[model samples]
Target: MKTKNNIRVGISIGDINGIGGEITLKAFEDSRMLEFCTPVIFASNKVIAFQKKHFGLEVNYNGVHEASQAVEGKVNIVNISKNAPKIEFGKETEEAGKYAFLSLKVAVEALKNNEVDVLVTAPINKHNIQSEEFRFPGHTDYLAKELNGEALMFMVTEDLKVGLMTDHIAVKDVSENITRNLILKKAAKIHDSLIRDFRIRKPKIAVLGINPHSGDNGVIGTEDDTVLKPAVAELFEKGIMAFGPYSADSFFGSDSYKKFDAVLAAYHDQGLIPFKTLSFGKGVNYTAGLDKVRTSPDHGTAYEIAGKGVADYQSFKEAVFTAIQIYRNREEYEELTSNPLKKASGNNR
Candidate 1:
């Protein structure tokens, strides 16, 4: 890892035709962003130049051949390809998918080697970015394989955090997937992330039920009562402050989610719909439980507004900030945990 003050942030430009380039450039236009971390964008200079010209933005960068050459306090462009693909705004092409994968592959390598302290990815089109090499549904699935630990799709804001028990799966499979072990694993990941990544001690987690109204005493579904309830009880017994199988329908609408440090929803839409509805432009999609820190904007490739310079860059900027904060928090967490007596005494303070 780099020095604490000079953490290197590796950025993989998402689909070339989308708002990835615009938002990324816009995020660093403030110049004060350099004080937070050194950004290494994994794309060619030609690609970046085209976006800069199109958006009419003035953000300077240092072009380099590799992440190792990235300099502190300056935006660095790690040239992955010399031949820049043709730009077709609001359109998805096989060429765009190829370059997207190339950028992501190189960036992940840099992350694995610790050339970059953290990764802040822009959104990619899931349908277009599919190939023989990249066969996963989304970043979370792919990252779980490339990175060290189980990946948890954690959508977060300062006051609200939501994690998915089963992501990128059909609704029909959600009930079958809600087993004791799955609940335990996801709950444990959320619990650990709250402490290490968010620096929340003794974090309270609420798990939303699999069925409506928590199955209404087994009328709608038995999985909530048979599987989810028991699993949550197990988590509590294991010393994790997890309580739930709470009705998903009213969890967020009733302001019940605000009571806990985080909420683990049974499936994707169950968690994300409410999360996005509440914190769409501001939320950061953090891949928690991974050895390396990774985060991305909550929104996707807004093809409808691509190249229009109308897409919001706040989420992308927040993702970058969140990745840096999580990296520093993990460092602090490791140091504190390494020294038991010091941690104990510090807790007392």
Candidate 2:
């Protein structure tokens, strides 16, 4: 059972061959983590035991048949599978992908059923975790389909938040993929997420340009002038407090990002490169504008350091913390907005 302070966190074990298990276990090594939220790992107890032995970790876990059976102050394992997949370090295998999907599927179901308060996913191998049933580029896309609301990949930290206009698409297709409607939709998502999830009353958003110097008045390209600029103007006029078609090259370099609450980049690399460079080990990839909260570490499955037991779990721990914070923020926001009269009286006081 979860208390007001302790939320149930549903965790999907990403790629059995990667650093998911390592980071997950490492984060829970500190017993203080359990004081805030009950963790429900969607994997087998045997697998977790194997990981513990391999990593030489002494953390104990409670094995249960379902997430609802999870108890506070303990790491709970919801044994989703009887036969645990073999762990092959630093390799992307079909078996690893299978189990990864299984873990994610069950965890998502629990989230939809309201059995879990929030979800913190470990990294999954984008190549191996593909099938007839599961055919999305990443967690954001799949979650958009499963959950209610439009999904935006909002990479966040204490001081920085970056959202992508286009994610998991080829660079050549980026310009075509980014349209006026797309920019409006993504920017709106970012604006709402900052206000609702981050507790920002009003958010200023920066949109990065698509071309060099934002097309340099059509000398380099026309997309920025024709598409991005107009979209940003429309957003601003509609009271979104959005600015830019700012040159991507100099925006972060000049520390212009510090002026805004969040940034909406044209593409994946445009946003992630700067985000990772600045806060790689401390950032959380939050799926914003979703009915439920889902977050992951900024970094992916570090295959090279998968089974070495030296993988940094700071980002994973931060992901957990961010998810919990956002969940609480949403709860508070809903409570305050549910009754306008109460909100008005409280405001007057």
Candidate 3:
């Protein structure tokens, strides 16, 4: 099934000091991976060499100038800057953060210019990567700004899909941020993603409550009734199949998340804690409602295992698979919508 129009995946080397290099190398170690798509990594040749040696990887990569020249069965590294920062494993430093941003910045530019079909970013330390130029909370926020679109942090896997409306924000401000308008916007984005990217034409979404037991009918709090219920009604009026201000605890407890296409949580840990708990090494963090495809591993930089070659690459591999699937699904969805009789198909992405 390999074709000339294989989707190109651009990968960003995360923290030079972390396991980004390890997992990335491991993910592409199999030559069969190239059968699906060509991969372009944004990192200096010197840095990649260090990572390969340090991790004792057997895979070989070709240092290419641009994404267009990427070769199948060969890892292509788009060397960003002739020189790169020093690698200091198990330690957080400014240089690690700088090069991490550099790799991401270069890969993002390639994606924006249509040189790459999708972006698969590695993990970066949110604290260390913060600079005056890059001030966003994480990849989702930064890409949302650069790409000029709202991003829903959609965590995906074979089993379930969960979206966080309030991500990377403090818990104290969670209640104040759950406005009706914000709910509607996130709901719309989720709907669009399910239809276009996931190929679910008539998708049903479940929304979780902000407070305990959905405010227990105003005993625990009032926002669940005052904000969430009305927001769900408004979304229903707009023809979106959104339900609940469901209780955070009981929803996942009873395995009710299995009943919907996607679940939108009021806050970060309210959803991710359970998602990660269930699908830790297999989850793909996808940024939906964007002009281009972007995904990352559900986990973060594990400095303790940096350069050890023991990091599990399953999540990173799933990220690449998910990005490619989304890109293809979006293309097919557009094709079908553009021509009704062309192909009324069900997706396997």
| Model 1 Cα RMSD, 1 decimal | 1.1
Candidate 2 vs candidate 3: the lDDT winner is: 2
Candidate 2: which pairs clash?
Answer: none
Model 3 has an lDDT value of: 0.90
lDDT, candidate 3, 1-349, per-residue tens: 2254478899999998888988999888887888888899999889988888887787788998887778776789998888778899878999889889989998999999888889999999998998988999999999998895888999998778899879999999999998999999999999999989887889899999999999999999999999999999999999999999899898987999989999999999999999998896899999998999999999889999887778999999999999988888887777777875565443332
> Can you give the TM-score per candidate against the true fold?
0.98, 0.98, 0.96
lDDT tens per residue, model 1, 43-94 = 9999999999999999999999999999998999999998989999999999
Segments of candidate 3 deviating more than 4 angstroms? 1-5, 343-349
| Superposed model 1: Cα runs more than 4 Å off | 1-4
Residue 2's lDDT within candidate 1 is 48
- Minimum summed lDDT over a 10-residue window in model 1 is located at 1-10
